[model samples]
Target: MRIMLDIGHPKDVNVFKNVILSLQEMGHTVKIFVRAKESTKRMLDDAGFEYEVCPYYKSMAGKAFGILANDLRLYMIARKFKPDVFVSPGSPYSAHVSSLMRKPHLAFSDTEIAGLVTMLTLPFTDKIYTSTSFYLDLGPKQERFKGYYELAYLHPKYFKPNKSVLDKYGLEEGYILLRLSALSSHHDLHASGFDFETEDELRDYISSLEKYGRVIISSEKLDWDTIKEYQLDLDPDDLHDIINYASICLSEGATMASEAAVLGIPSIYVSNTERGYLNELETEYDLVYNIPDRGEALEKTISFLQNKNTKDEWQSKKVVMLNHNIDVCNFIIDRIINIDKRGL
Candidate 1:
């Protein structure tokens, strides 16, 4: 079987990496198409996967125009590859091109708030897969799965925490990991996080975290001289290892927050927007705290930091979560094979 996978976000690389390897091991030809977004190329290169880089637009006007431009680019690529099916994390370009080629397009989506992308992509998609916790119902073509996209790579069967990553970065066991996302994506147009008035205020807030433990900051678009010393300077591939050993994760990004939760680390997600998976992790499993208000989120963070049994309690919660969910990479591979065999 010839399968074509499209990567629209940096996280998509991790989501598809294990699936790609498993498919190739099973003697299937796999081709990857990635957008020129932050860290997407670097991750693909480090993983040693051969992929083609597609064009992407950063500005709103460019993004509107990019729909047609990227659709044409992917259409040309699909024409040459002649894939059996197209798969992505709700990528409209793949959905549009696959439809034009008369091939089935399967999309896996978790963000219920990305209305524009869903509007453009789902109509062209043959099947749209989402986590069972997802809020919206996409009619008959939607399929609900029992696990998260993070589990495709971060499941215990695939990932093991390496304590060596801590020593390499001179980090102690209980260091706090802080992720400050730019929140510049299309879906994040109206979203907000970490309501600091200025860079100095943000720096001051980070400094306060050091009183509890060492703080390592990872920012997507940080250029402030005040927080330069605390900025994380490690390879992107080793991020999970860092997250695995952190005392707690404070992230403005939903993906990183959920990653920490799955690893059994207590996470505080500070965002106005909510994802159903994060809500489940917070309300059902008690592994994550999804607080929209910055003050409330900080209070929760300090509470977790001061508690001695938080980590152990989170690990117990993680076991329950694992028991309820499937190994997502294996699920994706098996589903793709079945889709091919059934000619669906």
Candidate 2:
């Protein structure tokens, strides 16, 4: 099978990297397509994957225009490559192109997309996949699966971590890892509330923890002042290494919280925003503690540290995840092949 993989969000590039190798190993001819937004070029370069850049912007407004442009872009790529399937993590633009080609469209989404977005694209995307065990009835056309939040394709099992990353960051022992995000782009206005205003309120709370340990604040969008004051040394490509070795993981982002859980590290997710994946993890996987609000983050952090029950529960849960886990690359490709056979 020939496959065209499109990455809408630059952050999802690691997943593209993982899926590309898996498809190639499965003997499929694979071509790459991604939006040229943010540090998208950097993501492609960091993963050592080469591709044709579409003249599409990453923002919502730009992507609406980029959709028409992507149709042209994907149309040209499809004419040259003639792939069997069009695959993405459910980008609205990718769905537009795949629908036009009458090819099976396989999109790997997580539990983060809003219902409105899913409803808008459900008609075009043939198979919409999520890692969550929850019933993903975004619409009648969508298909959800029990998977994970970690871009597992970039797992240490597949992509070896370079210790030089630690060297690059000059990270020694006794450092705390903090991941902060508003998740506003995800369309979950009511879930959590750790925005710049809320993050500022919690900033001193975290700094107070710094007295007990060193703190490194990581973000997708951060002010220069915070970065300078935190004095964080981080390599953009190899953050899991830092999370894996950290004494504690604190975040408002669902994916990083899940990553910390998968890595067996103590995780505190600030639940001031929409409770999508974090709600699932707390309910299904005993991986991390979900604080009701930022007000509880400090108390939860201390409770998680002092409670052996939390540690033991997570250990037990990790073993179960190991049993239930699927090689996402294999699983996704197998499904694609079957769908192709069905001529969807």
Candidate number of the best lDDT: 1
Question: Which residue pairs clash within candidate 2?
Answer: 131-147, 191-273, 191-274, 192-272, 192-273, 192-274, 193-272, 193-273
| Model 2 C-alpha lDDT per residue in residues 10-67, reported as the tens digit of each score | 5577666666776777787888887765467787887788787887553567645766
Residue 68 of model 2 has an lDDT of 76
Q: Per-residue CA lDDT of candidate 1, range 1-344, in tens?
A: 99989987888999999999999999999889988875898999999999877877887788889999889988888899999999999999999999999999989899999999999999999888999999899999898989999999889889988889888888889899888898878899899999677987887787778789988888886677755778878899899999999999999999999999999999999999989999988888888888888778777888889999998899999999999998889878877878957556
lDDT of each: 0.89, 0.68
lDDT of 1: 0.89
| C-alpha-based local distance difference test score of model 2 | 0.68
Q: For every candidate structure, what is the RMSD over all alpha carbons to the true structure, in angstroms?
A: 1.1, 3.1
